[model samples]
Target: MTEKLWVFDTTLRDGEQVPGCQLDTREKIIVAQALEALGVDVLEAGFPVSSPGDFKSVQEISKAVSNPTICALSRAVEKDIEVAADSLRFAKKGRIHTGIGVSGYHIQHKLRSTPEAVLERAVKAVTFAKNLVDEVEFYAEDAGRADKDYLAKIIEAVIKAGAKVVNIPDTTGYCLPVQYGALIRFLKENVSNIDQAIIATHCHNDLGLATANTLSGVENGARQVEVTMNGIGERAGNTSLEEVVMAIKCHSEIPVHTDIVTKKIYETSRIISKLMNMPIQPNKAIVGKNAFAHSSGIHQDGVLKFRENYEIIDPKDVGVEESSIVLTARSGRAALKHHLNLLGFPVEGEKLNEIYERFLELADTKRDIGRKELLSLIGEQMDHSLLVEIQDISYQGAEGKEANAEVTLEMGDKVLTGSSKGNGPVDAVIKSIKQLIEHKVILDEFLIQAMTKGSDDVCKVHMRIMHEGKPYYGFASETDIVLASARAFVDALNKLPIKATN
Candidate 1:
């Protein structure tokens, strides 16, 4: 029988610690439901005793989710355990995860207690939690640096106190895989009551080894792995769920089974990214934009001939549609032809050379050349006009508590000028542009993000508009964020029909 590994997802409790990645109560509940649908065995909802918002989020998540076991994090204090228990009252399966620092440095400085005192408190906390919930997990904070014998003592005490699960966490992410695995093996060998509870591995990613450490622990006898989606958490991150799950699936020698629905990984990742207003890195593993993208000539040729030659995993297996063979300046004839053929244009030899030259010229002017631009360039040679004659207008807004906007519009033998006032400079500019264009469209989503790091960074605005149940997206960038947002909204409005319709 294959050993089943429980996937404990701490995206809510730990992943929310990512800078600027805070989610409101409703958003936390939404993510918790998605996690349940994605088939996570355990959802670490939040630290109930941290704040009222966290407590409310944990309570709401416990009430909303029924399939997965809802967990709340707490310190080894009775008050904290009570808070955790109260928050998880509505959960079908509730778990209280409580821990205290056990390392020498932590015991001396952080806890201001001796090793024996810390061990006594660890056992007491677990016993207290066991009285409230049958499923209780105890974590030995900074266990990676703790003395092997002392760590074993704490684990033994907690297990004797009725902790169903014992988490050996590399709190500082300072241990190598070999050393971390050795620690878990040592605990298994030395701890008297080790067999009474399951061993869990919670590794941080400070040195980018959280997944490696977690996997190493599994090989050494850990049955549970604590992780987060997209590797989001405090400082660097926690173990990534996608990376570990895919690793276990692909590695036959270390066959581990999880309850996660692999197909829903991408969807959940995207939902969390959108809700947190954080952009997933294009090169991030599994769910990233470049995870399945191939660009090099040699690689593209091999992929065209046989996909398995370059790709170990199929994109469709992970719910991604297909691999993108992008054309760049370094692209060869084969790649160029492939992209052109994808655009419904099949040409060769002199025709291919002609188009390739034009592509190079356009590539030299722009960072990236789109299919529409390439088609237009090719159409110019066939006496076919593909250019849409819509004049693009630019607008800007002033700053201050009460700011105004100036708009300039240019049409054939006509120029329209307008101004408006509103709550903010961006709103004023948007209202002014609407007055000038007289277009009616519903703004579905409007977002502004800094394109680069700095105080005076360029702002990029992405806007979506819905008209007659169809949505259109537009984007624009400017040094001034308010003006960038206005321009993006106007650009989306321009995509709509000029005449009014119900």
Candidate 2:
């Protein structure tokens, strides 16, 4: 029988520590419910004593969720423990996760206390928190770099004092897999009361070795993996729950299994990203937009022939519908043909070769070839052009008393016209366009760079707009900077789900 590895998710607690990624009480409850539905064994809802808002969020999450052990974080102080305990009053299964710094650097610089004092504090905090809740987790803040003997001493003391789980974290993400695994093994071998508590691994990804270090811990006797969804946390972030769970499943030799609902991983990631307003990086593992996107010709061909040829895990197994074959300059005729067929353009032989050549030219000059671009390339009807199109645009100079622009947009067969003034020609054009459409949009970023150095040089305007906290990206190039900005803005607007007519 495979040993069960506890999936302790700290996305709400540690992951929320990302500078701007804080989730309110209602948002935290939504995420807690999603995590419970994902079948996490433990959910560290928040650091209750950190703030009243956090305390209320943890309390509400405890009330909202029941299957998973709802947990609240606390410091080594008695007040922190009390507040954390109070937050989980309604929880069916509650855990108090409290700890102190254990590394010599932290003890000397951060805490200004000696190892013995920190050790005493850790034990006391755990003993007190254990009295309030049956499940108590004690974390050694920087245990990866702490003195092995002293670390073992603290671990043994905390276990004897009543911690049911002792978390040895790579607080700074400073250890290599071998070094970190050795550290966990050292505690298992040297700590006399180790068996009294489950050993947990909470590794960070500062060095991009979080998953490796986490699996290493399991190899060396850790049965609990404390992680966050999409690895969203402070700095480089913590071990990713999806990654650790998938690792256990792929490497049957690891001898452990998690109760996580693998298929809900993608949905959970998106929910957190949307509520936190933190867009998931396109290349982030498991939940990233490009996690299953194949753009290379060789990779696309291989995947098209046999998914297993290029994919180790099926996309559906992780809630992703299917692997995306991105059409780009790097894509081959096979991928182009495949996508073209799907888009209702069935060209083969000479016609396909001609279109493929044109596609290469288009793709080389651009970043990607989506369906709209493909259709335009094949001389498809303007009826299916971009969601919005610039019919006519006129811009006054930027330094004029009042910059002015007249714009006309075509949405299907209808033409919408508007005009406005602004501080600059680009702004004037965008303001006029906004008068023509109905969408709450913020110009999050606007950038214009000259492709060439001359006065009449070609300019590329790249812009990002936010709608309901989600970003839409687009770019356009032209000799006139104002025109480029207008086109870029409209392109981005077209990508968004917006209403044009009243």
Global lDDT of each candidate? 0.81, 0.87
The C-alpha RMSD in Å for every predicted model, in order, reads 6.0, 7.0
**What is candidate 2's CA lDDT for residue 31?**
93
- In order of listing, the candidates' clash counts read 0, 0
Compare the candidates by TM-score and give the number of the best one: 1
Per-residue lDDT of candidate 2, residues 51-83 (tens digit): 889989988988898899998888899999999
The residue-by-residue lDDT of candidate 1 on 13-50, one tens digit each, is 89998888999999998899989998999999999999
- lDDT, residue 407, model 1: 70
Per lDDT, the best of the predicted structures is 2
Q: lDDT of candidate 1?
A: 0.81
Candidate 2 residue pairs in clash (backbone atoms < 3 Å): none
